[model samples]
Target: MAILDNTSLQLPKENPGAEDFLPLLGTDHVELYVGNAKQAAHYYISAWGFQPLAYAGLETGLKDKVSYVLQQDKIRLVLTSPLRSGGPINKHIDAHGDGVKAIALWVDDATKSHHETTKRGADSYLEPKTLKDKDGEVVLSGIHTYGETVHIFVERSNYNGVFLPGYISWNPHYKAPEVGLKYIDHMVGNVGWNEMDKWCRFYEKVMGFAQLISFDDKDISTEYTALMSKVMSNGNGRIKFPINEPAEGRKKSQIEEYIEFYNGAGVQHMAMATDNIIETVTALKNRGIEFLTVPASYYEDVLDRVGEIDEDLMPLKELSILIDRDDEGYLLQIFTKPILDRPTMFIEIIQRKGAKSFGKGNFKALFEAIEREQESRGTL
Candidate 1:
């Protein structure tokens, strides 16, 4: 499948200001530090239907680490593992387990992005470095964000090779058919207590983002758990990040549990956009992907709550999908159970019809579903 075209899409009007200095094309890739890249690659391939795209390791002359790049449309995932015992990759895995390390962004000029961000008070993670191969050259730079997560600016307009200079095109005999997933809709981060606004401001000041929306604990809480979130988006709305923090609740909040298990702040979920949520989610479900399911009662008066939508109510009710509406339009969304054993990271499948809002209307039902899972796991 080809990448989904988002050029014509329009978000809810919130004129933050003109974004000029740090222009982001879109999300290039999300890199995760894992214990075993090979097994992780297989899991994603078999379960999530990601096609192996590129690889870098001992065969590619990388002695310290190995990375497997998987792609499905515009969504790319780089699973990296340490080859040796004492490298920085190993240290990150030890500290955070298999979690996101980098949210690579596609930019026009890596050097200019780095300079502009650093000048705006961002901490440098990596200086601009150009990697060249026979195909072409790619310029890269990085800046530190919340926790140990880094945003790597990738300028690959000049490069034509497979991925970076070091990675080679990976074509295994075994390849999984792609799911209907098109691209990343948004990535949510779980920060510590009272840290959502801090990171939200960081995105605004350093990366030229705007506050899309803010949700307090009252807006997104069940009886047991609570958290606050603030959505931040890039100038052109190509990238969005909702920073969340644990809030005072009767029991442990989901963000607090993520912080405890992940050992610190990190990405909670990546909301993937699909043209048809019914087909995409059906494919995932058949492939053994477990989703957080709401009760059947949620379907009884759903249409009365959100008003008329294009989709039939039966399939949605059968599939346990959730729906929400805003002034713009309605959106259909579903969340997968934690993909890893640690219960830290997960994925959300979202189909936005004309709505720009982040399913705020479905918070109570969704969080209640999550709380049920937490109860089963004894985490809440």
Candidate 2:
């Protein structure tokens, strides 16, 4: 799917002669290794209003795994489960409950992507391979990143199947109206202690991404919790990954809690973009989606900090949406509680006005809200 058309989300100014060996079209798909693809698919469809797009499993000649593809606008999610026990898929499930396994990128040359990454120190996950069916051919290649997460390069300019060749159109009787989720804004990952810089450099040297921004613990800390984050972006600013690590604090940091419960470092949340957060949030909440809410006091002084915005303050305050502004523009965002029981993975709904920066201004209130949830869960 083509990326959502938004002038505010345009590419930022590129770095001076930064290596563009691996140019990406955009995020192709994010595949999560879930315990049950069917139930997970149902939850996203019913709660998030994602339409079923495709399916691949035993019926499609894949014996070991079953995958359900769901799409909403330009965002596509692949939920997969191992059909039988005792394999790499099972091992992954055992290691990290339900979490993201791969962040696929749309590219023009999968072979070149793989060659450049591996030659630059990334471990090979999958050699370049061509998959074809009636529609056309697609070339796929992959390389390993932090923890068990992989970046799969997908060359689909020549393909036109539902998802790929193996998957068939999945049109189920159950369907819901679109929730206005346009596309993925950014995805954040939590790593083990002192591993944030390692992965950040990997993205810089291996994947040719530049450090767009960085937040030390002081910039993103509360009274009792702290963590550090560094934002990495590709050449054209289409992909942004904010890698985070726990910092010393009086209480247990949220990143530490995620690492412990998740059995290691992994994706913490995937942020999706929408044009209208008030409507999008209203639809999601009415559909049983739960979000982390800051106290009403957060909004009392927000306008003074963020300046004037196009949206009204009452609806944003009532919905508990957080606002932040950069030199470019402001953005509205809200975070959901963990979608799974492990408290490892969650989702963020963000609407950028003209800002290319993440919600750094809201980190204090956001983390305080998270600390409250962690206290209730007894993980703090």
Candidate 3:
């Protein structure tokens, strides 16, 4: 139950003598099970500024489902939908509307990664399989994590196709301006009540991650709600997951609402990294992206708490962007309203100057903003 003040912020440390059995290169792609892949793909292309990369559907010889791949820099998103009723994709979409299904991780050897994690008590989601085409071959395997979300291990060193073996190059005439999004910074998961530590241990013992930092109800509470979080990171620092659970409070917390609507533990938000947050946020806003906003009074004393920063205070305040400083440096970030209809999944735009820590200084303002949104929806 340590409070993370600006002066006391610390980065995650690797576990002592922990062997890196599951060596992951980075995130390959994030797949979402939507209701319609074509329209969803158009939304991502027109609104989020993701470029079309590849496709696989009836034309590609698949009958049950269709997938559309989009890319922006190093970030890739795969949107899949069921072509027929009564399939798993339809069931997943029925349960959780347009949510992430697989968080694919890039690895050097998918077979070895699956063997190591499965031997460490992980539930097997997909066995080791090799997909081959004219370009090359790609090996893949998977393991179940919290809830229905699965982590797919992708080894594509031998593959040079557009995306995978079955997918073909998708070149569409419609294009949008790039938004300067670099890569996935981190993904946050919301578990049921008092289940944060269970998944934290799952990441530590099963996937070889170490505790980064922790925040309790005392550290992350408002007048009406509270939540606790513990961050876990891989040995190479390429992946980070912060597990959150609801704490006792005066009313419903955001984590509780997410769990109730999502029907189980799932990813709450994905934080995307940008080198120029001001420009990126501006483009996003121009494209009709709505963000959560705090009161003007919150900015009055923000500089006094965070000290001087490189960016001008007026622009950050104008866009309602939040700023926080760790021992290393400061970071600029902002959260979008739930993109989906269920108030479940959202996106975070962040730019790191040198800071490695999450925005502990801006928790109160951010949560208060979230509470305002919840109240409007009558869920708070």
Candidate 4:
């Protein structure tokens, strides 16, 4: 009996990399720890246009946590929350608010990644272990990241389980249609003050990642707050992780608030790629997802800056989407407000016309917009 008989998710396509930084096999799934899995799952499906994929909870025999899996194209999110009070999930909720807990990576070999990173001083969160059920078996290992965040290495080459051993196929009565979200472009992590380089070095030495892009205070600074960032990519460029550290500026930053609530460095936002930002965002907005509102004035000069675009500028202006152009091409990007109550994590919706670069031009405007939100929250 195969785990993925015929009605299962597809396996990741393997991309071979050198021993260094094991050019990320790909994103397996993103697991977010929310205060309520059921509500969060609803929010994702209703607002973000993600369709329910799989589930594990009391019915499946899991006593401690409930996880709802959602998917759009290759991007999958596992929303997990504690079913009871006074547990690790509660502690995490109280400390960090609702945020990403695990950025699981698809790998060919779990034990090798675990041993290599552990030997290089990575804190072990879970020892290399195998999980098996009637469907199939999966080998998994994990390591602690900033705060309570974790990087789970999933070796499913030999496993065909629905999701994992415990998770059964989720055939929901209601289904939300996909909104053209293809895959994760990059996942950004926010570290504490003056710690971006430390983690960058960790990835460089431990995982053999190279700095693909870097932004100093000058580049990312706004009127009230500022932060620095460096993008790290595996050899194949399939997996890109950007590390962010708050810079000493006039006022407190969004990154600082994340560190305060999250209690340390953790994932701030997961950038999802869409082939059509206008269509996707429009669908998302109609579905009830509220994006961060920027002023119309920001659009006055967008065309002049990014040159001509295929999208109608009027609609983009109405939606407050920011556009940026690089040598290769252009991109449209917008962000949502903190989906949780604590002002911690947010979502970024981006569409690449041809450019592979993060929106450097929009950083200042985006940060200023964020500062305004911080002002409203009395965080600054």
Q: Compose the digit string of candidate 4's lDDT tens values, residues 202-315.
A: 887787777888999999997778899998877767688999999988888899988877787788998999888889989988987778877888888888999999988999
Q: lDDT of each structure?
A: 0.90, 0.91, 0.90, 0.83
Candidates 2 and 4, the one with greater TM-score: 2
Clashes (backbone N, CA, C under 3 Å), per candidate, total 0, 0, 0, 1
Count residue pairs with overlapping backbones in model 2.
0
Clashing pairs in 3: none
RMSD of each: 2.3, 2.5, 6.0, 3.5
* Minimal lDDT window, size 10, model 2: 1-10
Ranking by lDDT: 2, 3, 1, 4
- Cα lDDT tens digits, model 1, 1-380, are 45323242334434366354678878999999999999999999998899988999999999889999999999999999998899888888888889999999988889999999999999999999999999889899999999999999999877777788999999999988888888999999999988888998888889888888899988988888899999998867779999999999999988998999999999999999999999999999999999988899999999998999999999999898999999889999999999989979999999999888898888999988888888899999
Which pairs of residues clash in candidate 4, taking residues 3 or more apart in a chain or in different chains? 21-207
Candidate 3 residue-wise lDDT, 1-380, digit = tens: 11111121133434443345677667889999999899999988888899999999999999999999999988899999999999789989888888999999988889999999999999999999999999999899999999899999998888777889999989999989889988999999999987999999999888888888899999899999999999888876778899999999999999999998998999999999999999999999999999999888878999998899888988888899999999989999999999999989999999999898999999999999999999999999
Clashing pairs in 1: none
For every model shown, what is its TM-score relative to the native structure? 0.96, 0.96, 0.95, 0.92
* Candidate 1 ranges beyond 4 A from true positions: 1-15
**For model 1, where is the 10-residue window of minimal lDDT?**
4-13
Cand. 2 TM to true fold: 0.96
Backbone clash pairs in model 3 (N, Cα, C under 3 Å; residues 3+ apart or in different chains), count: 0
Candidate ranking under TM-score, highest first, comes to: 2, 1, 3, 4
Q: Name the top lDDT candidate.
A: 2
